[model samples]
Target: MLNTSRRLWNQFFRKARKVNNEPLNKVSLIVLIVVDIFILINVVMGLDDISRWYISPSQAEPCYSQWQNYRTKTTTDKDFEIIKNSFFGIDNPLSQEQIYQQVEERHLGKVSQTCFQYAKYQEQINIPPNQQIIQNIEQKQIQVSQFEQSNSNIRAQYDSTLLEKIAGQSREKSINVVGAEKAKQELDQNNQRISTLKQEITNLKNQLVTKPESMNFLGFLQEDSNFNQVEVNYQQASFWYPSIQLGFQSLFLVPLILVALSIHNFAQRREYGLIALISWHLLVIFFLPLILKIFEFLQVGVLFRFTFDILSTLLGGLLFLISYVYILLIPIVGFGIIQLCQKVILNTKAQAVRRIQDSRCIQCAKKIRTHDTYCPHCGYYQYIECPNCHNLTYKYLSHCHQCGAFQESSHNHA
Candidate 1:
């Protein structure tokens, strides 16, 4: 039953995919970019809407391979280093030694001479706003329905008694009906208030959830040491903005998305194809972090903290705009380009669909990849094969373009 259900589901999805011709539509891409940009701006402005979209704030597992990852913390590191240097310059030798010991112990073999950050551990929210609200709404609605149902059941028994007391008298029946109607009206009014209150409560809860202090950024630190580190605790009995959390997560997500997109676009295309994709990603992820850190580093040199802030803000805008154009828009346009090449230029779909297993480049059998169209190394064409008879087939094949085979096969004379 499970397999059968899965097969049906897959069939439906495959058909849907074919009809769409791409994973995401232009409208979807535009919406994602618009929403992402809006959220990015909100995050920059300290609006606190970071994890609103599907992307959630993870523990920000830094990919050790990317230098950009380190740059992100560069500013914070500089702050610590400056504080450290100042301590040493003031002849506070013990404090500097303690700080170094803490760093060496905590970052041992992973981060050398890096200041420990006591950032709050945050996770991105996955529940849709509607889902979150609707869940509460649904519970209340169910309660309302249940109350009415139970009330009706009780009223049915009361009506029996009332009818008995009326004793077939028209006047008594009329009086009883009027009284019941009045009672029901009062009950309904109260119920409505309760329902309204439930809705209001849900909204308030959501509001609180989205507030800046809802998620603390202090718990993300390597908890081995606590004393003498930056005590960036969540205050107000708790604090830190969801917008920042989500927005930062979104910033992380965009590059991840772009990387995934490029991988899907050019994964099988070539060995060197990702050089461009990764390079762009590094600029956003690693370079942006690096530059911001540099500003932090030179904050002492230039004696201008605001300079770093301005540079970081400008960098954020530049990143968003570039992401919209290159990371976001490029994929939508690139999908069109792929389709155009397959239809107008080559009269065939991308060669990437042909890769079967082991990362073999479908187009030229050069490099391994997942979802690209052409062989980047040799520029070879990739083709789908008829599953039934093992003959090469076109993407839109109703029958095997090579041997007139359908996806399904029937017994035939060999």
Candidate 2:
């Protein structure tokens, strides 16, 4: 066992010496590192492209604005019905166009005045400080107040005059009079004006609430039933999403694993020859960029989202819960599994023997090892030292006294 271990150790140190001493071997190591870095960069860029594909520019996104418009139009239609029932009443139902016209006429003068005031304020900002900007603003404020007060006074006077005329008509001996009809007509016109103003105010407020700019993706998905069709489309797209993403991932990760294994092999074989090290590193460098280029052809994230949408539909809310839990636990579970394998299955004598024969763990085929009852690194048992020859021999093999000698079995004469 001692002899076998010494031989293996000697071999490793000799390889290390060649790798450290030879200029060509050192150059290959440097090339390998550079290539790994380049491959890593490409992987990052590919991931970014995938993200962009999934996220999509807000302006260019299909169905988003149309959904918003749909909401706005529906809201407007509902408001039309409410206004018709509340103000126009069953006796005199109004068309949408007629309601719009009445509302516009009711608010036209006031809206125009407000717009003029805003325009004047804009002009004020452009004026020089030497000019009476402040004084002009103050003057406009006073004028607005006076104008409102005067209109109120005029309305009050008209109301008082109307009441006095109605009272005078009532005082007549006979209740039936010519002026009563005129008074009734005047009151009816006044009530109609007030109703029009109220309806106009209600419609404007509703419009503000139902505007297209108010909705967002999450809110739309969560609350709005109108987006169900769009959601279904997305879900349908998701079916192919996983395959595209996995393909891209494999493109980069498979080569990365291969390159890493090659580097490890180069480290071991460096003692044998610089030619092996250089050739292995050359292969890694040659393939890394090619693997990365596959990303250019893949829209991984977009595909993923497309698939996810349908998956969500099929799985419902369970999909979201599973995804969340999986994302949170995958690393932890993976690390625990690795640790357990190392401590249990990989740390056996059979595994150690395989490692000695193959220069890698039999179970994983990823890590290198040396001869020992149990590997010092991986804790896998390999060979036991012969008591006499002090050489290594397989633990499971049967020999007379097990001297660890290389010999063929003979048949006993009967």
Candidate 3:
């Protein structure tokens, strides 16, 4: 086993240092290395782009996230703040009732539209009639949005005018009467306009909500059967998204790896040294991204999630122990792989058979003369005594060349 490991190490070192009989000068080697880097970068970029072809969990069920949040939590001041920041674009205080109404109206319209789109995607509903209803609601919402924006501008202008009037009164100890009255009138007109716009916006939202078609769509979305199924689909999609990405990336890369490997092998056989070298580089470059993607999948894929959930359930407060568990587990898994390679893949007798057949030194894999009793390159014994035939035979071989008898103890000498 030790001799086998040494020979394998030497073989890998030679392969890594140079491709078959192809002498690459430093400059050309650097150029090839640069080409490899560029190809690897593009492959990774292509993989990332292909991974996005599938709809993400968030995109697949946007309505579910919003609905889940709405159902799970009571309306809080933070919710009001989010609405104020997003819609009003201001930090000015507003009555809680107004904020709550706006919040409810916004969520209802958003949830209805998202659910309708989702239903269409799922092919659960007729698209034409529902599309028309969605368009109508969208148009009304747009109008309301326009009105609210205008109202915000007017309100800002009124506040500025009011502040100016107050400043004038404070500085002079007496107001500029004409300017003050003009500002006052402007403020009142601004206030009235703001009120009118708010009322119009409210009416538009109310009409959208009360419209029979809109109400029916919302009702359908609210049904336990429809909503529950959507939730289930979303959860499943979320759970499987990483696996789907990994599978797609694998599909994209496997073909490239196979093609490169085939070309490399063919080139090597034909002694097309340059083609073999380039194909070898391509094969390595292709594998780079596949390895990285696999690591990423292991970190974020379904297996990780399943494992984490199990740990969370089983350990709870002791979950931090998982870090230690992984630290130990990885080395054990690595040791098992090493043992597999040593015992099965790089078995001493198996390697010796191939080396002997190739007329190469069993200890170093270098060419040897047929009549040589010992390897010239490594100065190792070339033959061993066969117990069955009592004749000289190649060392580390499972059979004796003289009698064609099995040499089960052949590896014991090595």
TM-score of each: 0.19, 0.32, 0.62
Tens digit of per-residue lDDT, candidate 1, span 1-414: 354346345533432232212345676546545654664454344322333322211212121112223234655333222212221222333543355444445431222222322211111221244235435655776776776775665566556545655675554555344344555665676577667866775564555344343333222222324321222222210122333333455475556545644553453245443343333333244323323433333333232334444555778755445334335543565577656744674331233234444455533335635455555654544456577777655443346656787744311100
If candidate 3 were superposed on the true structure by all CA atoms, what would the RMSD be? Answer: 10.3
Q: In model 3, where do residues sit more than 4 Å from their true spots?
A: 1-13, 19-23, 49-185, 252-276, 341-349, 361-368, 371-414
Go through the candidates in order and give the clash count of each. 26, 10, 0
lDDT of 1: 0.41
Count of backbone collisions within predicted model 2: 10
- Model 3, range 225-320, lDDT digits (tens) per residue? 656866887888879989988998998999999999889757754656677778877887888788778767767788678877888898999988
lDDT tens string, model 2, 1-414?
354346445544443334333444576657756765775577667655543343222211234344445456645454323222222222445533344344445431111222233223223222233123333433554555554554454554555555656667344553333344454565565556555554654554444334342223223333565456444545544444445454555655566656755665555433335544444444444455544434333234443355556668778877766466446554565577557754574343444355446665332233444443454433545454555576765553333235635423211100
Cα lDDT, model 1, residue 401: 54
How many residue-pair clashes does candidate 3 contain?
0
Better of 1 and 2 by lDDT: 2
